[model samples]
Target: MYRLKQMNTLRNQIFLGFMLVMLIVLGCVGFFTYGQVSVLLRNNAEKHIQQTAVQAAGKLDVLLRQVDTFTAQVATSATIQRLMAQEAEGEKTTFAERQSMLQEIRKHEAYTTGIRSLELYTTDYRMLFPLTDVSLNSRVPQEWINEADAGMGRLVWLGLDPRNPDVVIAIRNVRLIDHSFSYAGYLMVQVEKNYFEFSVEGESADNGSGEMMGLFDGAGKLVTSDFPEGADVEGMLHSGAKTIELNGSTYMPIQKRSEATGWRIIILTPVNYAAEGISVLRTVVVVSVIIGGGLFLVMTFILSTMITRPILNLIKVMRGAKLGTLKPISVPSSAMEINELNNTYNQMVDSLNELIEVVYQKEIVQSRTELKALQAQINPHFLFNTLEAFYWALEEKGEEELAEIVVAMSGLFRYVIAKTDGDEWVTVGDELDHAERYLKIMDMRMVDRLSWSIEADEECRGAPVPKLLVQPLVENAILHGVEQRLGRGTVLLRATPSDRPGYTRIEVTDNGPGMDDEKLLALRCSLEKGLNSRSEGGNGVGLANVQKRLMLYVPGGEGLTVHSSEGQGTTVSFEIPNAHKGEVES
Candidate 1:
């Protein structure tokens, strides 16, 4: 009896612990699952509603466009053109005469076939034609007629027609080629309101059951609904045209809009159908756990619980470790089985982290060495020799020649040393000054063989560029490319400021021997793949460096382009933003 009482106490403790855990876990899982599903459905439904509204609005805009196009065609017709031409010739039209003329035009097959009704109003904003008496009561408010006259080239909605009560679209326009030929009149087209209502009705709304669709305006007015026509719409109408709600009993209310007509379409479905599987998913999670608990304990027999518990811990630890998350693993141990498992895990984690740290340090050192090697490739030795030659010439010359040589040397050395200071982009003036220096050196070598021009819209001069960017191309042209040709060769640089609204453009053109088609193709390929060693070692090293530097600061690196043809000439151009334009700073 004493042993049985002790066992009962142990059993009660285990039962209480399991009940507390189940309550906490179920709360997290059930609420999380409900929240996620609700959010997804709500977001999807709103997007669909907005898209539907946009499509309907677009269709309405198209109808308006159609009205504008037809009005334009009639306004330019030979008959109407001739009538306007006569009015310019000083022929006065009488009321009876104007009435007869308008009636004749209205009866014509072309006008009668396409238009529901037509009106021609005067410059003073008075109705002048289509008079009921053919001689009286045709005059209308001058302001209304003048409003139509002002709307030429555009379709203006004019509410309902006073006579026939149809929707009217109107335009007021006068065309004149020379000084004298001008006419004032408004063209109006009456459209049936039912036509618009019927077009929207084409959308299929019913989705089985007793469900239906509806439409409302922004003012909470029920325009047309799939529900019974005369029924009160207070329950269905919403102030804003876009919201979804559950209707009384079995319905899922989904609302959308026709932006063109400013009409809303709401659809409803039975809620019973949607909720059917929700309960089942909830039950499966809770009931399956309750039923399997006894069988699970029996099969495990104290072994599976011990093993599974540690595996779960290992899973938690590795997930954090892989993400470089600094969290330690801690799990309970009932006996030596779990205690040994915990010790083994900690050793493996420590060893793995140490190896990773060692590899990372080695990579950092190697990367620094490669960067230094790239810098050493562009030597200052080439510029020094050219500057020495220029100094001797300047010592024996006048102020003009001395000024020329000084400018040349300054430009050359600026570009040579520019690579070390950190900024990628320099002012346009700085780049152009660098180009002038490069040109001066080549000018000495080629004497009268080469000529160049740099013309930029004064507004464009403040644009930016990669440092030393313009010099390498000038070198490539004078050395391996264009300046080597025998004929009189020329290079031109031009820049235009963007009143074009997005980017700045600079262009450089050369009239020396341009690359054949094959060379241009190879250049494009090499650039995309980061250039080959043989290519980069040549002019490619400088070009690739220019390319890399530009990509860091400018969005589109490949925007640098060459336009050239075999036996013709080449134009290499690039564009970057002008920081002074107030678009981007630095």
Candidate 2:
């Protein structure tokens, strides 16, 4: 009963853990995917709305241009110009002349199809075209007259007519075209407000629910709108192409500015309609998560039973063996492998006592042999040469200097061969110490020509880095920079905190003849491409190897960097993220 309870507890814990992890992963993925998809849909809707507005604006511009063209045609006619010139001469009014002038004005208005009304006014405010209407002779608005006169010949929008609020009027100044273009009169053209409505209706026909469009003048007053309740005129004027909330619903509004009339064409669509696909996706994700979770629970329960049954049976046999009963045992299982394992365990009880001593002795001998084999892999010639050099140094130099060199060499070898917890990393302080040892060996070789210094920040010493990360870079500096120089040179190694957080920067610099631009560019290209070996006449193989290792082991460390100019020194540097700081210290 206790074992059964333990098995159920284990199964429940494992199932819960797996479910928790799956829920987190799926939730994050669904959230970000939904956000991205929603953004894409909104952007596409905005583009479509903007395109529609642009087309509508284009049509409106064409219509306005046509109005201006027709007004110019009538204003510049010879029949109107001759009568205007005659009227300007202050001749006693002749009925035939007045009738001829009125006939000319009517003839021009008849040719223009969309014009609701055309009225010709002399500069003195005498109405010409609608001579029969007594109200037409009323005093003309001074604002319209002044704007028309100021236009100089161009058409000017006089806004909606106050007397007939449904009409939008444009006016042009009439002038005689002899030598001096004298102001003769003004010509006004009126268009019904419904004309603008018809112009934009074709684009809005296919738009779905909560879709609306509006034409607003430059001052943001609505001239026409398709929606019965209209839009938030103030909000539409202040906002650009974006999504907003209106009347307890989300809306996406797009505005296109027309250069001809200084008007704005706005199209508003509901956000729900625009993101229809996202709604379906959200539903699918919810349903899939629910179904997937249920199936995972059922599968987990079955697998747990299969696994724990064999394990429990093995435990029972182990308990029996522990109680000193060395007899054959049997436990039935549905799995063939588990049954075979049970049979093997029963057979092992009979011979375990007999083979214990033999197995212990064999393991002891095997461990020793393996240790000796690993030690044998070290090159004997290199060790002999190192010893011979140590002997020669002892004979030539005194004990103190030779002893220092020997110690540095020993330290370098120890660092190279040391193993730590199966990880290929060390502290920055240890790596620097290894680099210093290498430089010390080289210093003895060059004696007077090579001088070096290693400067590292106290805080950075404990930062974790890959083993032997800096030694190769220092070696490269000595080989490529110091060896190629004529006079004495200095190599500097510096470790500091990097610009990015949780990273350290290590730089190796040499005060020797530097590379030219072409060579520098080629070397950088090779390093960036992760070229393993240096090209012919190239001197960056060691640096490349170090860069590749750093990139492999360090998460955010971008390989190495080299900066050099002709006749100046070179600086090679790289960064290491300070991961596993505690591990390195321990």
Candidate 3:
């Protein structure tokens, strides 16, 4: 019982809730921060390794291409080609001829650095540099010779020498620059391993990071490495893994292939180096969470006491409110929100009795007003009959024109004021009739100063539209466009099947002076505002009101458009979607 009572205390509950929320938040933040930081560091490390490998490979390719160019220069020299042609023609070369060829080979040795040797061989089986050593000739592999022959004059990389394993080899077959284009001889260039190793080492030393790189041949054999000896290079190169475990340490491997030499350059980066930042961040996060949790618990205790003490005082004061005593009670607290809350409660208490009395008075007045409104109601049919009686009385007195005006007025009133059961939709023909009556009344009232015409498609006459849809446009035309002009004006009402399917176009055009750009712009702005505000129609509906009503009544309706130029006629048009309705009696 005592534990339950303690748990029910408001200050204890608030402190426990805040502590629980803080713990969950810290745990989630730490988890996500650890995962995200680790991934980012790993990616950055791998990207660095990849860039290093590509740079090294690019340098090596430049050196190898230099050697290739030198070989091409010697193979295509005019003296060497002529001598090779002589040898191919079964002519025995004199010592002077062989010496000329030896000079030609020696001239190219200085073309590029790190060149171990350059040898040229013909069908006669002679080494140009060593003159009499068959061992130099014997060292040339038959497979290299065949591959060179198949090259048809283009250079091909033969990779590291298998016998010595310390030399890089390249060869190309030469062709005579003649009409026959006959095969000449083979030119082989041997590059020292130090040529490529020097570049890789220089790049590694410049980086200053403890990362190692190795160059592998096309067959995945390690040709040279900046890695320490016996570093399991073969397993690292062939395992095809992104990360490797070497000596119980993690390393990320990035490999790039050289387009020039078809060799693979592999770089290995220490994972520990990349994760050092992650370790520091982890320690900071742990310490911050512990310190923040302790401070949050202390603050939660202080805040709960400040909050619950005010609430308890307010509760004690509100106990009098339930007994129908309408009196203000004040609760003082240091918190701004608590003080504001107390002020609001006191104001509500002071206004409670006044509000009850005011509500009672408003109900009595509302009942009396409703009774008067009911008593003032009249049948719509009586007004229609009275107008008809006035029309006939004017006709009997030989005032035919006045009688016609009276009939049109009666129609205008009936259509505007009468309810069509609960349905707001009417046929286009009925709406046109309403517009015609309104136009007739306006034209008669203007003393022959106003005239109107309506041209409607027979098919469009039966389409459904909101009642009074067309009458307002005609009224607006006569009042604003025609009456505002100096002389007679004409209003043309056109109804036709719209180009858009399942729609009808209605246009009201006036021949009075049109609006200038400024007035037209203001009028358009008014219509747009009306559409947004959804202003409903009144007895004196203007263009904006008509547009709002059209938008409300017609499905998929876009309201109205006005086109006008100063001193020219104005045209207002709108499209209404066709709606299915019951047939109307003629």
Each prediction's total of clashing residue pairs, residues at least 3 apart in sequence or on different chains, is 7, 0, 0
Stretches off by above 4 angstroms in model 3 are 1-116, 120-188, 192-306, 309-320, 323-346, 364-389, 398-401, 414-430, 446-467, 476-504, 509-542, 551-556, 562-571, 578-586
Question: Which residue pairs clash in candidate 3?
Answer: none
lDDT of 3: 0.79
For TM-score, candidate 1 versus 2, the one ahead is 2
Off by over 4 Å in 1: 1-282, 289-407, 418-421, 479-481, 515-522, 525-537, 540-545, 556-558, 580-586
Best by lDDT: 3
Please, what is the whole-model Cα lDDT of each candidate in the order they appear?
Answer: 0.58, 0.76, 0.79
lDDT at position 433, candidate 1: 76
What's the C-alpha lDDT at position 102 in model 3? 68
Q: What are the per-residue Cα lDDT tens digits for candidate 1 across 1-586?
A: 9986865643344554565565556656766776676566556644544454455556556655665566666655655555554554556566666656564555453532335655654443344456543211243344545555565434555444445544444544546445343555555566544434423334424332344555454444554445655644446444432323443454555655544344455555445433445566667666756655554445444554444556566566567666765444665666676667767667666776787898999899999999998777556656665666676667667556665766677667756664544455677777777787778767767788878887777767777776677766666555545555777788877777754565577777777777888988887666565553233236434555555555666754355577778777777677777663222224
Sort the candidates on TM-score, descending order. Answer: 3, 2, 1
Q: How do the predictions measure up, each by TM-score?
A: 0.38, 0.48, 0.55
Q: Against the true structure, whose TM-score is highest?
A: 3
Write down the TM-score for model 1. Answer: 0.38
